[model samples]
Target: MPESTYPRTALQRGGVPVPPLALGSWNTWDRMSKDEAVALIRRATELDAGFFDIAYYNMGPHAENSRTDILFGEALRASGVDRDGITLCGKLWLWDWPNQGFRQQLVESLGRAGLERFDTVVVGDYGKVPDMPRLVAEVNALISEGLVDSWGINNWQIAHTTQALDEAETQGVVAPVVAQLKYGIARRSMAEGEAYGALFDAGVLTLQASDVFEGGILATGRQPERKVGADVGGIREQIAAIYPEVARVAAGFGVTPAALGIAFCLSNPATANVLFGASRLAQLEQNHAALELALAHGPEVRAALAGCWVDRDVRADGVW
Candidate 1:
């Protein structure tokens, strides 16, 4: 059976209403100049994409650059977006999820971003798989200290996230609500495969989906470099194979493939927020417009693109 698709408008993070689209700063460093990046941040704010996504990994050499939070801070300060108006979501490695290590990492991340608190902090991918009980304790402590509003996991396999949620429930701490994962036409394992479909069925709704463009696969104009963890060549082929169909469907609706892709995710009723990345104001505006168009044509596009999902051996290929 095909995975169920859902559509939802907003979700509350620390009492703030989050729109369905967010600004993702993954590997955005050096893609544009500082001034341009700041302007882009302001642009995102104007477009209601104020839920900014950042992580420590985005700052390290893996991206060949650094300090996404710092960049966002600069943009926020310059853009005049009130701290309370926009929400910041940060990611940490599992190794930092226990004891003082988690707290210290949060402190550093906050300091770098020039903020006292973030709306949500997630343990990005299970690196060494932190001790679940201790990890929950550390997360609860942060919430108690008011250092973070809500907490969750990102990029964790279904089994790990399921275990984390169960343990959090057993331990009587706030369970992780937002489980960030990759989901798009090019990366359909989590969305269509049973691995994460079960999670949605389990009542988890806040799925902050990133890479909706599939590392430049679905965009209309010149695509920026693909900057994510996946089989670049293989994904390119998958996108190539589907581009004609996506373009045809998009043209049929008088929208771009980018809009088709975003709409495809928006079609999923359970997805709370879909994250998109941009290094320029124009791109941000484009995606923001596409987001609204997606909402309008979400169901139709989902039906059209039903056969375009890259549902290869997900677990065997390690995409999960």
Candidate 2:
């Protein structure tokens, strides 16, 4: 499964094909200048990474405007990548729910991307079971009108995702083809546990983000000194302790630490794609190298790395 050998895995979602690995513009956009962001995106396109995930609410609390998507749109136009060959995936944030607000948000996403329509629009993390019906309905409506080619959910539990799919079936509409979940060596429940089972049975595609364990915690042996809000910091510490072993395993395959982390996600049968966020052209080149590394590492190497999930904090409840 070397990056080059794989070419790019494509899955049919809502009768459209989407790239198996998507370029995510989250922290990458926040950290880079607008020009840097555009360069990184262009580099990804040059490498044939055909999907970009942009968020309208990426700028942080005080920022009323979403410059990230706009910058991405400008870059796409400037690069001259045929819109037909690329898939633009954006999110519908919590604040932009309900009819009018959601419609406005969708319009803004299109405006920002400088595209006529998105290939996939993920309505993210409803957080509760009750809210799913409305969100699914709204997303289906958007799909019906050709505003978006497909719909998806991000950061949701198995139960909530299943409920949403059930609702979609009841309405005779397609359920989400993708579920964007936090999945990596440091984060596994959503991919390995009951959540994966539910999604698999329902024929939903799995899209994993934060695959490098959020900035080298799992891949680079670096952990944050301060405890951020919630459960992530502790897990990072645990992952830091195991980084040497991870590096050793990666060395066995002659790949970088980041590639090893990504390969672990790709090894999962449920995973249809891995989402990577790159702030620079160099970073995009490094991350895209995973495709080649994957092909070089055979089943034995993949099984060995998969068996290396030994950190307890990562397995603890609330980590997912």
Candidate 3:
């Protein structure tokens, strides 16, 4: 099925025509063969989940050396899909920001991915912007040079993002067009808390939401990693308890629990993209199914669900 079968493709911020659903390739390198990953990308295109995301993050040991981007580059090179057809978005982490040689990094990213330019480049997290002036200059310069098309911040709450955007606009620079966070049933703060308020008020980031599975918590229908922190334990417990309930509700709605999450996420007016990951073609089929199910329920039902989520903080922890 073409990407048209997917839900909303209007990322309004960058004029980037990205399907609401995308393939997330984070910390997945070193786990699969290059051919296997390329095949996955090629298949994702067919299903219209052509928007692909990777990160050059320094995850202590697991994702050192821009592992995600390195693997994604190989996958892109071998994907056999036309670069023009698929949207490529990558993340630049704190370890490599500002003077990280913006164009040089893009050159390396392009060489790794075998593409001339990335459709979008995002800050991996809201870590200190260091030199705000230098950051904006480098970001604008990338767009001007055509090395990167769109730029945004990820994982940073709205306060920093708001200030950055405000500064860029005041300075007549290209402000970020997208903002992302680790949002899911387990992590509601970004959606129901300050981050949402900040972006909603400013009208900058068209959401590029991530962590739908909550680092395997929602996907496995169980507890979260202890590393997710001690503070969120109660939230994790809530997710564990509510997962089956969600599954039941999804069943009543004639959809799966994951489908319910996807539908609910897309229903939000601010959400332009819901980032997801897959290890196989079968997962893309599930993505297609989720989209179809959400469509069947219609935007009204989805909107209702979305609102309930925000107002009730449904399935999210720490709402009280």
Task: State the lDDT of candidate 1 residue by residue for 1-320, as single tens digits.
Answer: 11112233434334445766687767674477778877776666666676788765532334343776677677677766677767788776664345437788788878887888878887766556568787888888888999987887777766677777888889888878786777776677765567677666566646777777767767753344555555533555656578778888888988767767777776776677888777777776666656666757777777888778765555622243
lDDT of 2 by residue, 1-320 (tens): 11233545444433644555678765546666767766766666566466788777642241346466677777667666667777788788764345335667788778776777877888764333446667777787778888887777776666666777788888888788776766777666555665465555555665555444555466557764422123443455565677888889878777767777776777666666778766667766766666666556646556776655644334322234
Instruction: Rank by lDDT, highest first.
Output: 1, 3, 2
**After best superposition, candidate 3 residue 38: deviation in angstroms?**
3.0
Q: How many residue pairs clash per model?
A: 5, 9, 1
Q: Between which residue pairs do clashes occur in model 3?
A: 3-48
RMSD of each: 5.1, 3.8, 4.1
The C-alpha lDDT values of all candidates are 0.69, 0.65, 0.65
Clashing pairs in 1: 5-268, 6-268, 6-269, 7-268, 7-269
State which candidate, 2 or 3, has the greater lDDT.
3
RMSD of 1: 5.1
Candidate 3 ranges beyond 4 A from true positions: 1-3, 59-63, 96-101, 126-129, 192-198, 201-203, 223-234, 298-320
| True-vs-predicted CA distance for residue 62, candidate 3, Å | 6.6
Question: For candidate 1, what is the lDDT?
Answer: 0.69
